[model samples]
Target: MNFLIADSFTSALARLTGQEQKQTKTAAFDLQLNPAQPGLQMHRLTNSRDPNFWSVRVNQDIRIIVHKTEASFMLAYVDHHDKAYSWADRRRIEAHPRTGAIQIVEVHERIEDTGPLFANLTVEPDAAPAQPASPPIFADLSEDALLDIGTPSDWISDILTWSEERYFQMSDRLPAEVAEALLEYAATGRLRSPELVPANPLEHPDTLRRVQTVATEDELRMALDFPWDKWSVFLHPSQREVVDADFSGPARVTGTAGTGKTIVALHRAARAVREDADARVLLTSFSRPLANALRAKLAILLADDPAKLGRVSIASFEDAASELFQLMTGRRPTFAPDDALQAAVERAIADLGYTDLAPRFVMAEWRQIVDAWNLVDLTSYAGVPRIGRRNRLGSKQREALWPVFEAMRAALAARGLVTRAQLFASVEAEFKAREEKPFTHVIVDEAQDLGVAELGMIGALASGPNALFFAGDLGQRIFQLPFSWLALGVDVRGRSSSLRINYRTSRQIREAADQLLPQKVRDVDGVEDDRTGAQSVFEGPPPTIIECADKADETRKVADYLRSAVEAGISPAEIGVFARSNDYLSRSRAAVAAAGLEGRQLTERAEDFGNCVSIGTMHLAKGLEFKAVVVMACDDEALPLQSRVDEATDEDELKEVFETERHLFYVACTRARDRLHISGVQPVSDFVADMALK
Candidate 1:
């Protein structure tokens, strides 16, 4: 017989103590090996609503609930003996009458006793809002229509009596697809078309998210090992379809943060290697920490298949370019350091007798336009878009400025130095000249940050059909300025898509963070990342927004918030403190010290701080999550980092600085999972005011 594990089993496992979890896992593994093992002491629950329910003894107080039948043996739940038995007695698993998808339902007879799945979703008695009777959000739907969406028959009346808030309150009791479907219908007044019932309910796309067959002892062991990381095995149908797709050419998936874009990239890489025995895949990102995080997750995803893992490689975009450059060209590329480049531009201006132009403007133009696009001559320089340069330059003025960039280029070459763009250009040339490429497929996670030359190299490297894939959010584009991907021959026009459901962040947090950007962001290529109509499946408290008199007052408030989080049972390591920049991190460090807790300051690398609360700048908070987050020191000078504003020479440059700064702040605030505390000095930043936290 086949064995399966339900999402309920993982939820129950998370509640047990460390020792209890260990013992329960051991019992679970043994049962998988031999379900009829006499040593497990399995007993059938005679009084269960589903007669197939059984209980296995884990210890004196713990019991494992199992669903047994002629064809399948499934682990359903685990808890203390009494609670485990009661759970089995109150729930039933069956195929939906209309959709034929499997669903685990809370029997209607026990509705009054059912508690909130997430503790934070439950409001205090004094804070509870009055719930007056209101019409149902789905009042127009009939019983058959509701059942077609996979709602259990017994819950129809209760669902019909629910208002929008009431539906959100009781959503956890419904299956994942049904909840998401109803949410969409309520928001946009659109319902998906119904499909005919399937012959085997277990094979339904939605059913796979709740239950899956374990093919072997090893597979079961892997599934139980990372109960919290079920995304590695049980994918949402939307994500599964993307992973298993074979695009005609390059494709891209864009979404807001926490919508599982990274997860899609990781799985797509695994799928590439698994499908083609001779294929090699490169999974890359623009940020080092994000690349490291992807490597770690890819390992957990492909742990059961080492051969497939071996076929895939993970590296940052710049690092991969350096490696490929060295492999083709005889030596490693030496990049022009920032200080040296600044000195070169200053000297170039002095030598050319052009004292009117600011050195900062010269540097920005050279980096973003001239060098980035490899404008070696005056003709190419005159034709470049200069996309964000609001103060347009005339052809006569461009001709006069061409000599300055030319001189800077000569000085860099004299010092045996190459810009990052030059190195990528060399690699792209080598790849384009050869018929064969290093990797058959290239999947980029943070593709929004790729530079012009970097995209060209990736396009050349991924030369085959269905070879290039990208996943990123346009709103999260902080590191790189806007550039047209289509202009570089990496078009995602027809194949582009967006994920609209978030499973990580709470609804309150998602909504608040989204205030930093518009609901829809369009790229230069005319593609849109529309964040409209998306919703989080869970709810959380309004963030604690605090503004104080001075830096000391801000530190004290953040320290007290930290203490409260710890007292409320959040681990110290599960909390994080962020600032606008590293120079301002001392305030966060002082707060952690005042709270009497240790903090691990994050570096560019992915390192474990070992039970210490994380302290870092908002930029370093990317690709990370915490149970609670404290964004401290959001004062006027510290936020827009007055230095960046003072350095801006033109309106376009100033606009870029402000947009990136806000994006960085948004990234930090959404890192929180449950709670958020944003504090600032008395004369606070405007971004804090935009949060409108209650």
Candidate 2:
């Protein structure tokens, strides 16, 4: 008989104690190995509404509920003996009548209280009489229309009585297609069905998503090992398309905060290496910590195949470029310090007799235009396109600025020091001379944060049609200014996809974070990031925003919240505290210390955060998640720090400063999953009030 495991079983198994889980796993393996063995005590339950329900004894008190048929045995639920029986009695497994997809549905029965029907229900003299129940949200739709989306037969009538809360609570029990469709309708006020419904619903993309068919002992054991991580084993149809699609050139996957972009990048890299014996793939991100996390997930993904694991290399963009530069040049690239570069620019300006030009504007021009494009001569500098740079420089201005940049470049080269951008340029040039690229496929996670030089190098490194893939969210773009990929020769237009289902964050938190951006955010290159239909699968209490009287008051409140989060079962490692800048880093650390939990400052490659709450700047909070998050020290000067604002010399620079600051807040706040507590001193940043309204 076929052995099927449902998401419900995995979730229940995750809650079992360590010893109980071990015993239950052994029982599960035995059942899969030989279901008819007499030593395995399986009892048919007469109390269950479905005749197929049976309980398998795991221990003296634990029971495994199984729905058995002649052709298949489904491990449906698990709990203590009585609770397991009660769960089985309240549910029945069957193939949906119209869609033909299998579903385990709650039995439809009404319990009548023996006590007088209205016995404790006294009506107040001023109260009106009770009204009849309301109908389902989509009651006007035809039965065929409903069934085509895989709505269960038994749930049809009861759906008419389900309130919004009830519908949300019961969503996990419904077929994924049905739940997703209903959620989409609820979110957009429009009912949408698939363009082509599958004839065999059991084999439909939606049906096979969360339910896996375990055919071997090893497969079952692997599934049990990571019981709660179903996303690792099963890919959503939306995610699978991005992972498996072939592109003529570079391609990208974009979504909001928690939409599984990283997972797709990891799986795409794995698949490329697995399918081609000679293929080498690089799975990369912008930061070392995030790259490490991706490596860990990739290890789990390729654990069964050593060859695939060996074929994939993982690194951050900086590390990858540095290694390539060192490999070709026989020396690591050293970067000139920012102070030295600025001083060089000062001397260059003095030598060029451009005293009228503002030093800030000249520096911006050097960094964003001349240095970014590696313009070697005055003519190229005068003609280079200033994409996102705000201050427009005429030919005279460019002529005056080019010499300063030239002198600065000469100074840095004289010291044998190169900026990261220069290193990337060197690496790209070295790879261009080779016939074969370093890696056959390159998958970039958190691609939104990559700089222009890094993008140019990545584009140069991938020489094949299906070599480049990126996964990121435009709403989380904080570090880099907007630029056209077409100009860089890495255009993802017509090859872009968006994921709508958010898996890492709760509905309340996602919604609040999303309000920071427009419904549709477009890049300067005209790539539209449409987030209209995105929805979270889970719900939680809305994030709490409090404005305290002072720093001490905010710290006290934040500490209390942190302690409460721990009391509510969030481990210290699962909590993160953040501030807008390093100015407030001490305050965050103090709050964590006051709460009696050790706090560890986060770094680019910090993995040893043992039993301590993480404290870091908002910039470092990217690509991380927490059960609870505290974003404190939101005084106006702290967030959107006055220094960045003061440094803006043009309209575009000011706008960029404000937008990136808001994105910073969005990234930090959305890192929370179940609970979020944002505290600040009175006169909190305007962004805090905006989030409160959301």
Candidate 3:
């Protein structure tokens, strides 16, 4: 049986066993060989009392025993430790009862310290003579073994440890084959790759048998025909491998813009639901628009199996949470009270003598009333009158006014004077009554924009085997608070993966836009496409940076570009004019209209081709795509608002907003499918001026 020790351990063991090593002292103890075997008895020895005596069990039930004496330490024995050696030393037993048995072996001794002992025992010394360090030979091995040294079994064990230690580094270096194999090993502790695992034999017995018959690599390659040219939803080869991993634990994906993250997520959802018709798979997105889009795509993907469709639920985080809250509370939740409630509350506060305070002040005072009474039932204050509007009311005044409002609300509900405010109050009352009951899962999209309170509300919906699948581009936060999904009670880092390929953009378009965008981004894999051809920013024209004297010149340049793009075979329906502010968009729209070009304002939900030309503020254009994008009024002041760089605000938030703008511009450029035209008036935004088209 071979005992494989690492080079260091082997060196340590060698040193400890050496006679010349002063520290190599043997310790005497009862050496019971084969304790479980019949006729075996413990034999004690007292000739030496050295703690350096070493015994290690290795593969195939073999144990190596070592001990030191005055002149030389012994490589005492190598045998199955489970067998009987002899009787006690006091019993006059034969040292070697078996005539042909060899009890001891000798080897050269090394140094005598703890360091050498540890090194000898744990590591194997390099067999090669002193020479310059050579590159590892396994570097060019098959993708399967490129990541780890040793045989397949050792590779598997190495990966498990590697994943635990340098997970991030390993994850970055993970080859496609390794990822595929790891997934298989995770699901079944065997060294089988996912591709080698037979598909459901019951469904494809003949195909499985045929695949099994293919023995050699050449035969296997010849027998199987893989479609490499087909369009796939995976963002990267690693993502594709993970999807095929079939492991039990949650998986994570992370990626830059246009990396097909949504596509991979949708595919994972579909595959999960398909694998088990009874499994309840929930698909969630941060935004309603993305949710709706995924739902539509999934509906088409799973149309063949009606039962499977029912098992998959695609919903926005809020909608899903609201549904769960309703299920637990036995009633729907009212959204936070709108302007009408504020107005009503102000009126009551005014009647109570204080009119200087805003509705926010009245709401704060109302909160105090609820807290004081310990009244979880907010519905009781549905029609309540406020004490004062804005003035500093004493505790006594607040106390006196509480009963009046409570009584008024009770009286109103009894008389059917309940308004939307009353209905919303009832919902709040219901929510408070059953706040403990959580939902099964609450998935969020655009989580980077979610606030802590919003996340808490969503978290409250988790009651059962709950899991959150939040997808967000931190670089695209247009909202106020940057929500951290990790902080929101989710193991984001563990389940996270990335889609880095810009599937939506052509190579040239991606390159050009990347150069123009000021954020650091890694290149994407598999972004090239042959059918639609490469996307060049120059296909239509060089980004027109017109020197506009003022707003009028800006409008003229936009109008002229709009007409020229159309005349140059670019469809008007494909063109979009984006501005940093809404005012600029409106001006551009009027200017285009006066030039006899039909223009429409673009919105998040607006359908494509609704207008001959579209105009929009940058914020409004997020998540929307357009072919030919013209960025107008690219002035320094408007491009990067001072608030964007404010130290008080989160840097990540600013970066996200900045990246989103860049990605949005990239998205806009890619929308053309064949041509991308970008235009800006000078002095162009810093970002536009730095643009380089490939």
lDDT string, candidate 1, 604-651, tens digits: 888989779999999889989888999999998887789999988788
After superposition, candidate 3 runs with Cα above 4 Å error: 1-236, 245-251, 325-447, 457-467, 515-547, 567-569, 591-600, 603-611, 636-694
Worst 10 residues of 2 by lDDT: 227-236
RMSD of each: 4.8, 3.7, 25.0
From the highest lDDT down, the ranking of the candidates is: 1, 2, 3
Better of 1 and 3 by TM-score: 1
TM-score of each: 0.91, 0.88, 0.47
308-351: candidate 2 lDDT, tens digit per residue? 88888899888999888888988998888899888988888888
- Residue-wise lDDT of candidate 3 within 240-282, one digit each (tens)? 6545544323234544445555656666666766775545666
Clashes of each: 0, 0, 46
Q: Which is superior by TM-score, 1 or 2? A: 1
Candidate 2 stretches greater than 4 Å from native: 1-4, 16-46, 51-75, 80-82, 94-102, 108-122, 125-136, 160-166, 187-208, 213-221, 228-233, 350-359, 433-435, 606-612
Candidate 2 backbone collisions, by pair: none
Clashing pairs in 1: none
